[model samples]
Target chain A: MRGIFSDGPRTALTAFYWAFLLYLLLPLTLMMAMSFKDASFVAFPIGNWTLDWYGKVMQDKQFLDACLYSVMIAAASMVAATTLGTWIAMLIVAEGIRGRMIIFALACLPAVVPGMISAISLRIFISTIDMPTGTAAIILGHTVHAVPFVVVMALTRLRSMPGNLVDAARDLGADNVVAFFRVTLPYLGPALLGGMIFCVLLSIDDFVRTFFLGGYRPTLPMLIFAKVQGGMSPEINAMATIVLVVTAAVGLYAEYMTRRARTR
Target chain B: MEPVVQFDQINKSYGKHVAVDNLNLSIEGGKFVTLLGPSGCGKSTSLRMLGGFETPTSGRILLSGKDVTRVPPNKRNVNIVFQDYALFPHMNVAKNIAFGLELKGLDNQRIHRRVSELLELVQLQDYAHRLPAELSGGQRQRVALMRALAPDPDVLLLDEPLSALDAKLRQQMQIELKAIQEKTGKTFMFVTHDQEEALTMSDTIVVMNKGRIEQMGDPDTLYGRPGSVFVANFIGETNLLRSTVLGVEGDTASLNWNGITITANQGGLTPKPGEHLYVVLRPESIHCSVTEPATGNRIKGKIRQRVFKGNHTSLSVDVGDGTLLNALVHPSDVAQLSGEDIWVGWKAETSTVIPDRQAHN
Candidate 1:
């Protein structure tokens, strides 16, 4: 296995992989670097590094309020999405219900469809019903958008699990309900955890759906978009840097957990 | 003894294909019965139906005297050991065995005691803390058995439980399983595709073919008097010779081969003239001698090939009618006849005649 790296073509391929990774990370890296600039403007490769911009962002009341609102909405949306998604996945995989394929396809439809279409359609429907598009509306939109991903990930895990284990439990004198709680649920722990993490990240990072639904209360993404239109400020860069770092840390941790699970 | 479980007029079908048709069987309490068959012969399907994992399309199943046809598997007083063992990967040996007792709401002290007893019974007391993946194939099989038997079900169903082990281990486990079954005195219904496993382990064997029971009897009766040509061919090695029934006199029947006539045991069946039949002769039944025998049912043939098989020699002889017959002679008998014209003779009572069916293409 180590000998394969000695060849020129293999070396070139390895370099290409690194290059692709860097390309994907470039924008986030730049945003973080510019956040430390002494200058008031968000500029890359600044002459001086300072913490003044981060302090300014911390003190900004609008940014602080938006961050708080976004956190609450995202948390609420994730809890709703994960619960509903896990229920749907368990039913489809374990129960073998009629029209399961149609239901599964419908559950996953939101993931592949354009976010703008979903956002605008939700906006129109909510407006007709006179529902206020504030924190609650944005939370609802995020939940709708993030649920399909949770379902897909959880359902794949549930489907791949050996059904023989469940049957074995029943044969060992467990009723259907007891078997599901004792055997099936425990086996799904890691997958369900991973799905929950993914749902949280998705709900927090949503921009298009939140944009249409946020009428009075602004989420972090909407706040950042407004700052970008007002000529990129160093405060905006500082906030971006924090979001990027947190998301990257969570993403890496999730990846490590999933890889370890795969190896086992 | 009365049967502990009974399947009466059971029929199961999937779509248009019949998986098991009118399967009726009774398993006596504390007796070991084996359902033996080739693949797709419905042996596993029948066991699944009995385990309540499957329901018959039309029929009733009785446990002792109560009808349990519609009862779910978890409610039925039966347990199954799957071919793959199906041990809980996340749980250790002790937890796996205790799971059934825990489900029944047994006291913690009783569950622990029973689990320890089962662990000792399977001879894996030291491996109680080890996961299923850490154990060897045979050890996993034992653990699976302990898990199913821990509940003290009225019946135990083993589905090809030893098929996953190596040949040597399989043979060892066969004896261990028999010993365990005898010690527990629990009704056991094991299913296997291996003929030798069925013969060596079962008190009663039910041979199945194409979703139907071909024959069911003790090992000796199944081997000596198979009910059909299928049962005879499937049970053990036997040479079948095409012949026509000449007549039946008392307990023996005279049959005419291609160019010769011989007498065979009637076996309670009357044969008419011109009826094509098959004469089954075990290789060991035929005796080979250098000198042509003047008496008994004898045939002269030149030895075509002689292969040594450690304790015995297998001789194939051509008896002038383009038919090759095989005879098993011991090494001592081989010294008297080697690659020469010889006489083959068998007692009339040792051979069985069956109605000849269409030959396979």
Candidate 2:
């Protein structure tokens, strides 16, 4: 009875939880608040607020072009990574396939490698291969990094999937191709969606790899980095706050979808 | 007519361990044939082979007199109901049922008609729009059955489909499954380790042991006249009395048990004189009495123990010479037995004898 409802430990745990949440959100909250500051420079003080900075960031042609370019690259890399990752996951889960553990480890290596090390290595690789630094190179680098996340997520879901579903389909007169498309693909839908969204987020937030593999055209992260080099401004904060909110919403939706799939 | 399915001298071995060894069986069409054995005895393996999921190691499988040893599952005219009731989670009951029909290039109208008819047969018409996860266990099982039956394959394979249900629901499904089989008149190859399930639903039961067929017969024959000691022990509770055959007369053999000479049916075995054999005596066949009445074979023994089993009382009688025989008595008749000493008797025709094969193997 004493252990059931101990108020002393409960109070301590509640205080710790709130402290952790505050620590995590305080920086992001400050950045978002600064986006509404009326002053041209970013500072911590009680000042007048306006939406002029957001409007300016939204109207900047260079910022809009960088955002569009980053979106196109993310879209391309998401498709590539999802396809390759899902295939590798299926191969790992398939029966009679030897060296599956080795394959899975190799496929997931990129996710563990340091971002700077991977970026430097990719820069060297593109130079050695006589390929120029551009959108294609950036897409390739992003695909390599994002593939591991997709593989890990899809493999986890695939492991939980019942083996009999495919067998039942084949027994009901479906060929291997048809069975995979009709049964296996639909079963992997939620995991693939989550993985693809994660890939998009990973690509959009990546800077080290893009820094090493950029052409004349700048991406959103590169553009923001270039702008930050000048000085900290509410306009830059406004742009970052927009990216942050959109990415957070997308991440939440992915979590919601996969969680719903799991419950179903 | 040719057999619907035949395993011609099939052998399946995974490296050193043989899952199936030299199995030869022919299944008749429109009959409920069951492969009954313990797990790893190759009952499910045999059903999977017939379903074209597993290939035999050294022999051929013929379906309707056509060799299908190399045909894949999709090419074979067979469908299976998996134990887990592997219904498509993404599709509703009606869509799941129409999957096979759609693959077969059936028009939407025909597929829709077939799906509705199957749902109606299983009394799941209202559940046609529900997902597999939304249905009860019994309802999901019915959906799986209807899904496999949608295409109307030549044979239906059930790999312990009813094992997942609760005891009472399993019993109800057993009767429903038999009724469905009779109404469809389709060739069904079922596999189960539960002998009662095999006995209740199968027209022919194949008992397997150590990856080999021990016996295959109708339920009545397998129960009343089991060909082997394993079959006798596996099918139901039975007491084996080890004895030596004195002589064979007609279809009966005279066995010398302790000092009492008992005549028993030979059970298709012509044992030579002085041959060791076991008399398979079902507990229900032995009647317990206080007085040694005019009977065929009587053994005077003490009642070691009595267990009241609702309808009948099971008594363990200690016959002389370190022998304990079990007998079933009615509760009322058991109440009359006041003394520990009693006489247990059974007719000569009721007990069957099989030669002891333990030492030879």
Candidate 3:
């Protein structure tokens, strides 16, 4: 018993780190437990345990449709953000020092501001332009908001690479396009996957932005919010548990990809 | 034949700091030429311009009698072996060598053959499937060389390619590089700061100083007849004697070194009387003796220190007036000499006079 905790010195920083982790996880753990309770309402101490809510969520058309829309939006956002972000990162890093500073500042404006204000501003801009609000609009919003993260990730990886690798590629008879695809892109694989996973998560879990930008077709989080208006229900817990499982699966896949890219 | 590469007054600058200034240099065809200089002397900058990795701020570049000043690196017919052996960390040895061939749109069979041939050329045929990270430093260097060479470029530029090797391995690679140059007979443009490596490998040496070419000649000519005090000091160990020129004869310059009259070969540098100059003498050329009976170019001093080298002995003599003379003599000669008075002398043909320039400071 002593040997297990004795491995670490139990310093203040380590204690604080575990404490913050517990604070983040306790609420989610309680929600997951309530999903399995066979009660009419949600509670921590359960008299009966069953998977009735989870079974009901699977058959509910509204919940299934919301889940389908969320998956589509998140997938679309992942592709768009990762592609555009990688290109922008390369362009910014290759620019002169002053140019890099200005461009980076402009790109990070959304991230520095509060998400609600940015989302509402984006909604106003879109409505003013007469563009329809739908899953596509939500995907666009998520992509714009997630681009800064992807750019930062790609920039970090590109910066860590040896400066002469690109030059060496050109010297070996590869043109600019070929050199980038062959040398630069390979090094950015792990970073791109990481950015892509984060974008997927952001698009799925985003609530305020989806409420402002999404059209008649609602996403899973919007549906969950609507269901929670009256009171807490086990069906909401069921949907949350499903989303959690999906997120964990995607995260595991991303970890596998990052490890594979690192080996090559 | 036209020279393989030419830089016509090429100038490269970063903002206000000029990296290369009006560099007018031409590399002759099918010769091993070395651009020898210390770091920040613009040798690497000149090489980079030739490789088209960096554009000249002004002036033009030519290759095969055609202007290629604005051409990108891949569009040029030259390849460079980078200093740190920039092999793609993700590729195997075979793939690395085949990179250029594939870029040229060659078919798979041809690329495979070319990769195999280059692997055998660099003697790494057994390690074709191994990645660059798995190879040793010297092995990776050879892979970089073979990868650049597989393109069959007109000129191969190497930027300090052997600097990352151990001393003995560096020496071995120097001989192999020279042998490869001979076998292929490509116009090789090499860069290095090690004077001994330059002398050992280059058929023509271009000594650079502060963004300008100081001297260009064969190794023997560059060593024996340096044009300026900088060249003389940069190429090898030398004993510099400050003197005022009394006058110039046809091929000989007469100077007074602290009231001791000395005549040396001018080597085409003409200086008028009462002008400051320097007499450049090699340490090995000056023989040391105990007695004062010397024939030519002799100086008297007391032996301050004696060092026994492998094949020669070096003596440090204080010849008064805060001037110290370094002389290399036979190792057997130090057996009979002690802290007594000695004489240092060299033949007239081995020493030359160069005009003194204070701008070097």
Ranking by lDDT: 2, 3, 1
Best by TM-score: 2
Best by lDDT: 2
Report, for every candidate in turn, its global Cα lDDT versus the true structure.
Answer: 0.87, 0.92, 0.88
> Model 2, residue B144: displacement in angstroms?
1.3
> Which fraction of the native contacts appears in each prediction?
0.81, 0.88, 0.83
Off by over 4 Å in 3: A1-18, A47-53, A96-98, A252-256, A259-264, B12-18, B245-255, B266-276, B306-313, B329-332, B358-361
Question: B194-269, model 3: which lDDT tens digit per residue?
Answer: 9999999999999998888999999999999988888899999998888999988888888899888878888778
Residue lDDT tens for model 2, A1-264: 566367788888988999999999999999999999988877879389899999999899999999999999999999999999999999998889999989999998999999999999999999999999999999999999999999998998888888889999999889999999999999999999999999999999999999999898999999999999999999999999999999999999999998898788
Query: Is 1 or 2 the stronger prediction by TM-score?
Result: 2
lDDT of 3: 0.88
**Candidate order, DockQ descending:** 2, 1, 3
Candidate 1 ranges beyond 4 A from true positions: A1-19, A52-68, A94-98, B247-250, B270-276, B293-295, B305-313, B331-337, B355-361
Q: Is model 1 an incorrect, acceptable, medium or high docking prediction?
A: medium
lDDT of 2 at B150: 86
> Is model 3 an incorrect, acceptable, medium or high docking prediction?
medium
